[model samples]
Target: MIPARLAAAALAAAALAVLPAAAARAEVEVDPTRYAALGDSYSSGTGTGDYFDETCLRSNRAYPQLLANGLGAELAFAACSGATTSDLLSKQLGSLDAETDLVTVTIGGNDIGWAEAVTACITPLTDCMDEIEASETLVEEHLPGLLDGAYGAITNRAPNAAVYVLGYPRLFNGERTCGALKQPNVAEQVRMNQAADRLAEVLQGKAEEHGFTYVDVRDAFAGHAICDDVAYLNGLTYPPAESYHPNEMGHLNGYYPALSRAIA
Candidate 1:
């Protein structure tokens, strides 16, 4: 009777072990089909050559739309052009909920006055480096705290979601090009791209602290930046506001592939 009892207990233990493995497999098998995209102009597809709304400037060619289509997920696209981190906290969080399974964010540019810096760079007689330095200071002093707040809110609203914080590509190719830029120099371009890199570093640190993914697109845009033969980013557009934003090809080829690979 003792031998028989020992055999039954061992069998029960083995069954329990198998149960956990089975449960893990079940969890892995569940598809992420409810996705929410929240961020600023880069995520909104501004300068992508098409717009859903003039105010928001979202494009069907945007990476978020492409990602949703590829994954067959139901999407709630809440990104908007010119939206800052504060705007995201106030306006975009409404699209997220407990049931959301995936999220992608691309903010912090406007918060650090990226547009203003570019404007300063383009205008003659203004010290572009000074403006750029001030923006960098803002990035160092305030951007991290803002990101923490935004990430905290996102996690609170959608606890189950896998969040991905996407970084910006370097706008210039580190070379002078034919396109007439107001700055018209490689040094300023390099400085601006370095500032962008710094911003990405801060954002990546925040994402890691919060257990979220950070997708870097810098390498992917290597030869396709603003000065490249086939430029992914727009130089100086008709509307000066559109300057320095990614064009349609940038969204399709650069952002889409980088994000798709990350999720896959």
Candidate 2:
């Protein structure tokens, strides 16, 4: 038999010894193998300097890859670049199942003809505002129902998964730094950012309606937009098609941190 004080001390030591193992078990309970990534260009890492596939442009630097690596989650599926909500319903939903525990999506930009709006802004004689407003009308009228259907399909497919609907960042830094022919003016850039904000709001509302999380990247990319001194978004690339997409730093610094925090 030991002294009462000594016995109490020994019990305390035993409890301390059990804590680390219990914590480790808790960590393992997360099931890292069940993650699936789905979305459009930003999620696919379009302008991130490297590609896993030419057509998909899936970059190893994308936020999904980063989160998967950090959490030791198996990235079982990833579809991005050029994918719209309709595309997601037709093609990407096949990747999710009841086993899927984690998912991230960034879409709807393509659905509203975001690329066309950008082209209109850069084209010599096109009315950029008119084009943008037309796109906004689509967002207001058509996009909600489309998003709801997409979200329903996703949740139906991956019944147990935690779905995160990520939104795009503003592409401009409220400045007119690029060539007049290559980029929109400061006023137009502001309007573009506002449109992006409106889209994000719509996405957030849809996500809430479907029991999913909405991750906003606008603030993260504020100082790193196309016209910034150290821009994270590509500004009128040689091919010109790469303009306004997030580069490597944008995905890593701008996207990854925000996603990590949200999942945490």
* Best of the candidates, TM-score: 2
**Model 1 Cα lDDT, one tens digit per residue, 132-243:** 9999999999899999999999999988788899999998876884465446367778899899999989999999999999999998788998878998998888776567
The true-versus-predicted C-alpha distance at residue 132 of model 1, in Å, is 0.6
TM-score of 1: 0.86
TM-score of each: 0.86, 0.87
Kindly report which residue stretches of model 2 are placed more than 4 angstroms away from their true locations once superposed: 1-31, 180-182
User: lDDT for every model?
Assistant: 0.84, 0.81
Q: Backbone clashes per model, in order?
A: 0, 0
Off by over 4 Å in 1: 1-32, 181-184
What's the CA error at residue 148 for candidate 1, in Å? 0.5
